[model samples]
Target: MKIPILIVMLLLLTSATSKKMWKTRYFTKHVVQQQDTWCVHACMEMSFGIPQCMALHRWLEYSQQLIFPTLNCCDLITPDNYCNCVEHGGVARSEISSFLRQQFSPISGVFTDLWDFLPRGDIVQLAFLSVRYTSTYHLVVLREVEQVEDYLWDILYCDPEVGYSTRVYNPNKLEIIY
Candidate 1:
C-alpha cells in the first residue's frame, strides 16, 4: 500500500511539473509609422521585425519597379512629393499582399472569423473604419489574442499611428486581413 501510494504521488508530481503554462507572446518592440501614409509600412515592419527606414526602402524599391518606375526614395522626402508619389493617399491591400508574396513566402489569407481561427503568437493585419474619421479606413497588426473568460477575449495589437502596443477587451470593430 505504501509503495502504491508513493508511486501515485510521484506520477502526479511529475505530471504537474511537466505541464506547460500558457503565456501571452507578442512583439516586444513597437514600430511606429514614420509618415502619415506609412501605417501599412509600419505594421509590416512590426510584423517582419525590421526597422522603419528599411521597410520604407523595401516598399519604395518594390513600388518603383512595378507601380512607379521613376519614383525614388529620396524624391519623396517632402510631404508634397510623398503625397504625389502615393496618389491614393495610402497603400492598397493588394499591393501589400503582392509585396509580401514576393519578398516572403505567401503566409496570409483573409479570415472573417479570426477569433476562432487565429493562433496564439501569430501576427496578423486588421482593417477597420477609423474611429475619428468614419469614412476612412485604418490598419493595425494583431499581435496576440487572450481569452479572458468563457465568452470574453482580450486583443493585443500594435497601432502604427498610435506608436505602441495596446490591449483592448473584445474588439469587434476590426476585420482580419492576411
Candidate 2:
C-alpha cells in the first residue's frame, strides 16, 4: 500500500515540473541528408528532430497543392532527379517562409542586415546561397554569426555543397525562421 502511494506522489511531482525549458540538440548525429537542394529539408529536420523521409513527404504534399497536382512527392527521388533537385529545382522563398510559419508558430522571421542582428546565442536561420557558376540556389541553415562592431566578423552555416563554410554573403531575402 505504501509503495503504491509513493509511486503516485512521484508521478505527480514529475508532472508539476516547469514546462519552459530550452535545450540545444544536434540532429546531425541521428540523421543527415547530405544532398543538393535539400538544404531546406535538412534544416527542417534538424530544427524539429525529424527524419528526412518525413520532411520529403511534407514537401511532396505541399508541392502537389501549389505547383503540380499530378506529380507525387513520394515517387522515388534519386540524386539524378529529386523533387526539388536540379531537374525540378527548389521551392521559392515565400513557400518555405509561409510553410514554416504555419507549421511552427514559435518561429520568427528576421529580414535584416546580419550586422544589425545582435544575436545573444546560437540561432538558426534558413538561408539561400547563390551558386557561383550557374543561375541556381541552394539551401543553408545560418547557424551562428560573430561580429566585433564591423571590424571583425564571420558567419557559420551548414549546406550539402559546402558541408559547413564560413563566408560573407548578403542573404537574398533570407527566410530566417527561428
The candidate maximizing lDDT is: 1
lDDT of 2 by residue, 1-178 (tens): 9999999999978765622221233334223454555666666665566555556556655665564445444455655664453344345655766655655544554344443443423443333332333565455555554442233445555554444545553333333334
Clash count in backbone of candidate 2: 0
> Residue 44, candidate 2: how far off, in angstroms?
1.8
Model 1 TM-score, 2 decimals: 0.60
Estimate the overall C-alpha local distance difference test score of candidate 1. Answer: 0.57
Cα displacement (Å) at residue 96, model 1: 4.0
lDDT of 1 by residue, 30-98 (tens): 776777777766766666676555566667667666555564554565755545435433655557656
**Candidate 2 accuracy as lDDT:** 0.50
lDDT of each: 0.57, 0.50
